[model samples]
Target: MNKLSKLALSIGSVPAWAFTTGIVLAAESVKVNPPKYSVVSVGALLSGLVSAAIIIAAILAFVYLVWGGLNWLTSGGDKTKTEEAQKRITSAIIGLAIVAASWALIQLIANVFGLNFQEGITIPEIQTNK
Candidate 1:
């Protein structure tokens, strides 16, 4: 087939494809359930993200500590390797400390300001005349 004929043939099938797709979609009666929790505002999203970050940081810190311990155990009396492993352990401890301190600080600020981080912030909506 020539280019023009091929293009014409392809274009002619578009309506048939659309009709088939519409029929198939109309044949199904799908029900969607409402979500248990809905994110109503950006503040809620940020709060959720922070909570997830805290959990991830804690898990990562634990993994790093265990990895450092294994490295140290397998160092086999090498001073350089031992030193590296010690640094890793120190870093992991520092990371864990930072995460804890930040969480404490957030809690303290929340208490001082009477802001509820757990429930997240809700901005008042401004309604306009339709």
Candidate 2:
């Protein structure tokens, strides 16, 4: 499609918040109950979300670090530019380390809180005579 048509189509599409609100408000008096937790279970998707957050943060941090290193290598010993790049690399490492540590901390907290995200318990089966 032409650029103008693409722009028009994009603009014509309903904005997410407005569309969500329209649907939400249209549903009058609909109720949703909060999820319940059992003594042995945690909410589904919590662990997956935690791991996804760590992975995303690590990838972003690594990208920034590589960009910074390239900038530093190209600085030709210019003090200001080199120092700024060094700072960027340092901050990226710190950020990635913090993200990694946060993942560990979350697991520790989960264990302490006795939460398990597995949906079901497993049991071994016994062999039967043919």
Q: Distance from true position, residue 14, model 1, in Å?
A: 4.9
Model 2 residue 67 distance off true place after TM-score fit, in angstroms: 1.2
Model 1: per-residue Cα lDDT at residue 127 = 100
Per-candidate TM-scores read 0.71, 0.54
What digit string (tens of lDDT, one per residue) describes model 1 on residues 1-130? Answer: 9999999999999998887733343556778775778776887887888888998999999999999999999999999999999999999999999999989998898788777779985656889999
The residue-by-residue lDDT of candidate 2 on 23-122, one tens digit each, is: 3345568687665743332344555556667889999999989989999999999999999999999999999899888877876776786754344322
- Superposed model 1: Cα runs more than 4 Å off: 1-33
Candidate 1, residue 74: how far the Cα is off, in Å: 1.4
CA shift of 32, model 1, Å: 6.3
Best by lDDT: 1
Please report, in order, the local distance difference test score of every candidate based on alpha carbons: 0.89, 0.76
